[model samples]
Target: MTTFSNYIPQSNPPLPPWETLPTMYDLPSDNPEEPGLPDDFHFLQPLLLYLTFQPINWNPELVYSAADLNLYYDIQHPLWYKRPDWFGVVGVGKLYKGQDLRLSYVTWQEPANPFVVIELLSPGTEDEDLGTRTESAADKPPRKWEVYERILRIPYYIVFSRYTNELLAFQLVGGHYEPMNLTHGCLLMPEINLSLGLWQGSFRDIERLWLRWFTLEGELIPAPTEEAAAATQRAIIAEQEAIEAKQEAIEAKQEAIEAKQEAIEAKRKTEQLAERLRQLGVNPDDLDEFL
Candidate 1:
């Protein structure tokens, strides 16, 4: 029974809250609105990727990787981004512009897109990470698959589930992603002279199946701690070998001294025997003729 004209009129159509709300910059990086915050596995798995993402064919200074960092892809929508679990770039500097740490990875500003992106599948993000999620509406931003595959065109996309210890990998080919085959239990990337595979062992003192890097020949790439431990072991072995060598030298010197002492004693006995033969009035030089 109230007159409709009395109420304040709204716009022709109200925009969605996302369209009018604060941009990514206005909100804190860890804002509640952000999805996929790192759980225990998410944190550790990405760390493993970051530690062992060495590309033997590339310069160490030019190889860079990051975890859970905002990767701004679209220049049109500068605020739109995806925070990958872990990503690596081959031609980028370790620091932003070789001067400072990067707050986020902006593709438009950077020289290269990610060569590889790894997503740890979780209950919350399994569908999206595997590219099976429902497509987004036309007005909404594209899904992670679309962003990585179609927009950014990342070379490699990897998904791993810790619960089942399963690994899935895709390589971009002819502008679309194709499932990659595992060679020798690893996905080989010859350009980097490296491989990606799951390793069953202890990491960070926790033993489990973990996704890690390897050589194309299926050799495990040692983490920094593992490398340090190996170096220590080599040093210990070298020290032991040196100690053994020193003991051998000492034994040889002692044997030579004993031989010299024995020779001296024999000479002294011979001299005394000669003196006795002379005192007995028997010429010692005549003994050879009697023989």
Candidate 2:
């Protein structure tokens, strides 16, 4: 029989890297047991949300934000958890138990559920993040959508796609999550007196479109570092203005002294002229009008 290899010919051209190589997400670690590695976008997008979230009506001490932290929801299961990309809580202390940093968020223990939850979409977890992924098994833990929508009943939900630069928002209305349209490139949440939106700017020296919080009127709520920088600038301007005022005062004083000297000299010359006129046998009193 003819060999199978003899009938197969070499390919005409080499396959491109896209076709030949595995993507980063697909390339598993040598340790299959190890957790998946997080890419740079995953690191940055959540940090932006953490930094810019400032609730206008809430107490700063009671406002807490978490990223990639396990949130235990069900008291019955006690082990069932959903780790959001980023979540913000109002009326919860930044510290766990009001004294220590949180290792993980326990929803039953906290006073309230998160006011807002944001997820940055990646190819690996896109379907589940958007709540479209089906149950892997009937008895497996509930999907993220069910946990947030039904169990926790989180007030606001947000998902952002880095590849397409798309942002979507949902609000809890009538016991269900409802899609909310962007008003002037922003989604306003009246409860917090703050808005969420995308802004094109540099953060951490990397320039890109970043999601940030804004005032309901669409004013950016500045980060703490930005607030400090602006305060420093104001101080510098105030110092410069004070220096200019001082210089102007000094110049005005100098001009007034010079004017006084000129008036004194003029009076002195008039008296001397009167003495000379008297010496020339002219009556100074009679020459007063001409002088």
Best by TM-score: 1
Candidate 1 per-residue lDDT, tens place, 236-285, comes to: 99999999999999999999999999999999999999999999999999
Q: Name the weakest run of 10 consecutive residues (lDDT summed) in model 1.
A: 25-34
The alpha-carbon root-mean-square deviation between model 1 and the true structure, to one decimal in Å, is: 14.8
What is the model-wide C-alpha lDDT for candidate 2? 0.85
| Candidate 2, superposed: residue stretches over 4 Å from native | 1-37, 134-137, 272-291
How close is every model to the real structure, measured as TM-score?
A: 0.81, 0.80
For residues 146-180, write the lDDT of model 2, one tens digit per residue. Answer: 78888899999999987899998888888888899
Point out the worst 10-residue segment of candidate 2 by lDDT: 29-38
lDDT of 1: 0.91
